[model samples]
Target: MSSTPSTVLDRFLRYVQIDTQSDPNSTAQPSTEKQKDLSRLLVTELFEMGVLDAHLDEHGYVYATLPANTTKYNVPVICFCSHVDTSPDCSGAGVKPIVHTKWDGSDIVLPDDLSQVLRQSEHPDLTAQIGNDIVTASGATLLGADNKAGVAEIMDAVYFLINNPDIKHGTIKILFTPDEEIGRGTAKVDLEKLGAAFGYTIDGESVGTLEDETFSADAVKITISGVSTHPGFAKGKLENALKIAADVLATLPKDTLSPETTEDMEGFIHPTNIEGILEKVTLGFIIRDFTVAGLHEKETYLKRILENVLTNYPHSTAHFEVIEQYRNMKEVLDQHPQVSDYALEAIRRSGLTAKRRSIRGGTDGSRLSFMGLPCPNIFAGEHAFHSKLEWVSVQDMQKAVEVIVNLCQIWEEKA
Candidate 1:
């Protein structure tokens, strides 16, 4: 709240200790009730900083507003967003964050688990954090810096704007969402109540990077029902569902169109889950691409593979289903060039060279863009997220705060 460098780090430290891991198998809006533990605390902290409108909704969303300090009436309302929940890929419980103050740039061995190590060779991003304070979690859990660093930076920027009223800016909005890790971040957000013309999600990685494009995504499920018979009399009478499903998976292309083999602009269809018995089996997959046509092409290709595999199991019947996920945000951002231009200018004003790039994964902004808010992503300096080796730099977080503060002023100036 004092605009000090420690404010962001302190906030980050406080946030990462909370166990806010979201469950992908849950049916609730947030996918986890523990997510509210962090949301409630955020609201209280915002209220302490003079944000009277700060409140947490029933769906575990935290929303707050900072009134305009400028005389200009044309400044568009801008919102800064981040997610509260950490990924389900790793454990986030009982997190112990350790800050390496003025780090000398060496491999960090997590205290909880001797085997867990953060090496500069594996993560090239550490090469840039030579003299900055680096934060990481104990060996057993993730640090939760994926988006909490963004949350802290936004909080610090809001506090700076509040204390320095002379630095004029337009009305600003703050939104903290839950379940972004499970793809439900924007599922229950009230856009009309938010009422922001343009927005930015402080959820990117690296320093001085802005992302306007993201992968268009979809989920596919294939269920197979096979004829079953007792093992003793199962010579030709038994068509095992598990074996049928395995055949389909094995038939998929192993050298191409996968998460491990794709990079940059390449698309991937990833098999995420498979569960079954002798009579029935369900296979789950996620398809990602930069375009709608690409998504369809991959989906069709996957189905073709499934169909060909089913030819060997005549008695087995299968059902294929596809679920629509968020699309590429660039399709919407292209209509509002000023949204990114102002952000780039703000980053430059903060004394950093801005690099406009595209993310291989989707963010909360991807859906919010189509929801009538042209939101892009800003860097929060998080690396190796959703793992025990997840880390964030204090200097990088402070720079994010400066970028956010500058963005407010830039929007007011351009108005």
Candidate 2:
């Protein structure tokens, strides 16, 4: 009953067919009730596999345990985790997965939309997937591979371990979280009950990547207030707040401080939303940097721009607010080097050259690391995530499952 490539592919395709897009504006724990759709299904499958404790909690998280089959009590408890919710940036409803069996190194034109093409040059990983089975959506919606691929790989790995009891391993924990795409994946996690010494998030891009660092994140809000007056008498008395807000946006550095302009450790001050009227305007921004000092610097620069813009409009005033989101996971991961080292070793045992990388965005692992569970991210073969062109190779997904299995064995052997 070992999991073959077909098992992983089948699970991913089925999971994506269900809509589980999380909501960022929702204040609820799960953000969207539909996320529980996949959560319930995962619990049912886990229970059928003999993991009787598998159940969805009040917060819509699915937690289960795979008891250690080994006599080594000293082996540390390890958890394999992934999120069930997909990103809200794109539509995840009614996904139709298209499988390209035995890719022939040609550009993949999505069926639903010919304009949405997966170019081999844009996706260098496709070079290695030439002969592998690649899965994608129909171009009308995102493939949900960002984390669903991770969910399937984790489930298949559990199935393999349970079916092959001869494989010695430590007590393994399985966690499927909701609202991760909204940045609240572990908000209600009961770490005391989980009791795992360490964990790994199967929520990264590419097959050979093991990410230990993530960008330190912050949220910023700027509000502008302007005088309201009749248009007929507005010659010298009225100052439009909407115009002031536009000025601030226009003043933001185009080449140095934007998501489109920054890359590879360079931080950015990105304006995510702007809404305003003639009298009042609000601007929402997300700030990201690899270091705390860098985050602060970007915030300071942003405020300076707002101040300078308001200087011209004497009657108008502005307010700037900064909210702490999450910090770099490396701050905590550095304290426990073995957590990442074991994963790199496991990747090698799975017959792939390990590549240590840092993500430009944050993950559930980033939040968990600061929440007392030192967790790093492992690759799940996702590429071009949060887009209609997103895709993943079945062969790479199987390799990720192998890494999870090897990681379990390495923990027991080292113990």
Candidate 3:
């Protein structure tokens, strides 16, 4: 089964036009109401395409089951999932996508400011994309290609599967999740309802990149308290919490730390927020490492620094809390090598070489894998994610749809 670039581009544009940026602070399911705008459309489209079971759950997860035509083989139920939400880091609203009809391997301008060009000098990958129609934002907002492309591809694949029943497939499940950007996409996923032995999330970048490994992550919250006094008499009586907070912040090693300073297998302590003043202060940090032992070592290093500070400043107290966010999915995926191997062969059959890549950030697949699904991530052919400069080749986007269809066919062949 195959789809043209135009079909995939039209679907992708329609999805990106909807405002579905997730709110991390929201207390509701789906995180933001606007996310449903896309979910409802997806549900409507699925039903129109003859997927009777397609419907949105109470929490806004859209699930549809395409029942197998041939039950003799007892094929394994497989799932293809993607999130509908874009990152809260940028505006996903009012996206004006500009398609370069045929990119000439040069810099392209976004909609808001023509002066702000997505320079080829900065992105050498664009050189490989010459003569391809690239979809990009107008500089006013992010293109929402992060997972919108994923959603579009999933939709395209579903249509392809329906139109071509002779292709042979097992029971295929499709899920469009919300709030993946805020790290809660899998929170409401009913695993039993999904009924897939293993799954693939169409949420990665490039044509061949497969991510089955991710960092072990945790968040640390630190609060400091001190006695506030009048400036004139404060020299001896006051213990400035702001100063102590600065001291503690300075204690984190400056030599090799933070996301900007590290890459690949390296780990870092990223300081995300700080607030309050002289008498009280609060801080938040995200710790990430590829291995559990390394993550634990980083935690020990952080605890040691705080203990030293508390010993030096007895009157000024501090409260520290560490919460584990997600673990390395490798532990779970390693137990089921067939999941990764199957996905690899599927990509190979699509005429693209598959390369395994370790994701610096975790995915919903990480949580799902640990939850006993043994899920891995497949590429959606997007790049420069979570930014206004983000873009994706229309050719690549359609190829992703082909890959999904091929995966289903490959699974059936093996069965």
Candidate 4:
């Protein structure tokens, strides 16, 4: 039993109206208290869907269990996951979702300071969306489709399954994580307790897109220390940290080389932020690569770049720290081919073609896979994520619910 677009849209709009922007600078587990608002709502919805055990943990993770009803199907329990936090890039508060009925596929201008033309020429997919309602944000705020669409789809699928018990399925677990945008969504995830042999995260972009691979990412923070003296009396004896920081930046391959210049399988070092003075400076960068070997190569190259810069300016003490955020899930998922096969078959059963793709960034699934749960990402029909131009197709979202239902059926059949 698939959910109707009208119903999914209503749920999505209600979820986005809550402000759950995660904080990157915060040391808290969930990062923001407002995230609890959505988590609590999800808990209530799950209980209403007949998942009587639905509850939110102390860390704001909402979980529920639909115990196995079919004795013939003894497949290991499966789970569906999505994050409740929106990016801190914009305000997620007071979000006003605008629903456009029968999209003409023209450029949509929002009341905020953004204009996005779904140029029919640019997106052929927009063609399929003609006569379908699309939900977007007024240029002032991000539409929260990034993961809310995922959340809505998960909720809808659970409710649909609850209403239709004839569908053969095993135990199903549902979870809504918080602070995923900040990269710590799964840090405290109780994997042993989750009890899912494999799961799917409904957070991909395109209708057919299924991402099982992603870049192994790391964040580097470089601190350059130098002797500072009065600029008015400065001479060759004075060493400026700001100048050293500039030299280190210059050592990088090229300033223009970025995500725009890079393509598939191309690794690049992105300088995200920098701030400091003549005495000390701190520069931040994110290094991304599809393979760990390539990641190591890039890391070594960066260290060499810094050493080369240090050679140019003697006596400058440069200290750097790099922390790995997430690893590529491909290698792990590759070993478990069933995970991908189940997802592909599920999408196909939903009447949508399955297209295996790569994630430009990471998802909570990546971390979950590494944590003994082979989790691949499923699409939720949301596009232009994390911006005011974000939009989701009503029909595709309904299809996502079907896909989720199909996934459980496929799993039981295989088992």
lDDT of 3 by residue, 1-415 (tens): 5332236788999999999999999999989988999999999989998999998988989999998876556788889999999999988888999899888876787759776589888876687789999999999889999999999999988888888878889999998899999999999999998899989999998778789999999988888897799989987678888888888889888778678889999999888899999889998889999998888888778878877976767788888888999999999999988888988887887888889999999999999998978889999988899888899999888778888888888788888
Candidate 1 per-residue lDDT over residues 96-152, each given as its tens digit: 999999999788999999899999999998898898899999899999999899999
Stretches > 4 Å off in candidate 4: 2-6, 112-125, 231-234, 255-257
- Measured on C-alpha atoms, candidate 3 has an lDDT of 0.88
C-alpha lDDT of residue 5 in model 4: 29
Clashing pairs in 3: 111-138
TM-score of each: 0.95, 0.96, 0.96, 0.95
lDDT values of the candidates?
0.92, 0.93, 0.88, 0.86
User: For model 2, how does the per-residue alpha-carbon lDDT over 297-379 read when each residue is reduced to its tens digit?
Assistant: 99999999999999889999988999999999999999999999999999999889999999999999999999999999999
TM-score for candidate 4, residues paired by index: 0.95
lDDT of 4 by residue, 1-415 (tens): 6333235777999999999999999998789999999999888877776789998998889888888777864698999999999999887888989999988777666766645544567656677788888888877788899899999998888777777778889999998999999888997888888888888999998897789999899888889988887878877767888888787777776533367778877878888888988888999999999998888888788888888877766778889798988999998999999999889999998888899988879999999999999999999998878877788998889889889989888888888
